[model samples]
Target: MPAIKDSRIIILATNGFEQSELEVPLNELRKAGARVDVVSLKEGEITGWDKNDWGTAVKVDHTIADARVTAYDALVLPGGQINPDLLRVEDDAVAFIREFHASGKPVAAICHAPWLLIEAGLMRGRRATSYHSIHTDMENAGAIWEDKPCVRDGNMITSRKPDDLGAFVKAIIDAVEENASARVAAE
Candidate 1:
């Protein structure tokens, strides 16, 4: 992957985010030259989940209430049973996601993170994939769900689990790069 000069990426996560799911993709995106911002429901550090135990903490760059979708080129949602579950209940988080999608920006969610999409009402008629447990919920939300490593439908991308982080990151970087090029061409 090449450095994505001038591109900015936002990862929306909270406490209980799958450890590897957030770190791996964050590292990859940085290596690819995108400025990554870890945004959450609040300021301060957010904890990660490492399998059965708690993992490291990542500092939150901005709170959900302060995030402006127009400032970012892409969005990432890292999943854990608790992270997205908690995020979906926050009106601000859900609204932020809804605005990000409505703005036609690239949005990627891995594992259970797509639950935010369901909560934000952005899944209708869109094709997506998520951790196996939420397939039905995605279907119920009106999305054409698939069981794949990664699925990119329009500006949204989704993956199944931590194992899919590589694919998930690649899809998001590609989407952001493509979006950048398209915007440049249009201008």
Candidate 2:
């Protein structure tokens, strides 16, 4: 992997996203010189789910209808029970995830965000990890489920929870910096 100063990453989420899951990777990826956009269903702001209640509102940089998959080097999905649940049902969101992954771009999902991957049909026969509660979901999606902090299979990455954000963020940076062909060969 080379320097990622010019890498553009999309952090796709919506209302009820887990606070740390979105913020940690967004801030860290930016600090590492990657351009990250908080793309959502709408253009205003989306509130996060801290733990039990609502957290801070994160500005939406672009709407799903407007964001082009070709414009980004990677996609990051932040998880919370409600976040992925809401996103997986949106046809546009699922199409974006599928097309992004099919293009061989990096796609990282943490916690329950793998639900979106499941919706995208990107989990079959892949090695992955997610929130313990979603182990069955992953298995049902044909993913080789594990309990690790971070699991990287080809250009896709998955982690257990906010506690695994460090590894998850690092994985995305690595994936972005790595050669696209190399990632496909890694599959």
Query: Which candidate gets the maximum lDDT versus the true structure?
Result: 2
Residue-level lDDT of model 1, residues 1-187, one tens digit each, is 2336679899999999999999998999999888999999888999999999999999999998888998899999999999999999999889899989899989999999999999999899999999999999999999999999999999999999988887898898889888888888788
Q: Considering only N, C-alpha and C atoms within 3 Å, which residue pairs clash in candidate 2?
A: none
Give per-residue lDDT, candidate 1, residue 185. Answer: 79
Q: lDDT by residue for model 2 over 1-187, one digit each (tens)?
A: 3567777889999999999999999999999998899999988999999998999999999999999998999999999999999999999999999999999888999999999999999999999999999999899999999999999999899999998988998898888888544645788
For all the candidates, what are their Cα RMSDs to the real structure? Answer: 1.5, 2.8
TM-score of 1: 0.97
State the number of backbone clashes in model 2. Answer: 0
Candidate 2 Cα misplacement greater than 4 A, ranges = 180-187
TM-score on alpha carbons, each prediction = 0.97, 0.95
**Best model per TM-score:** 1
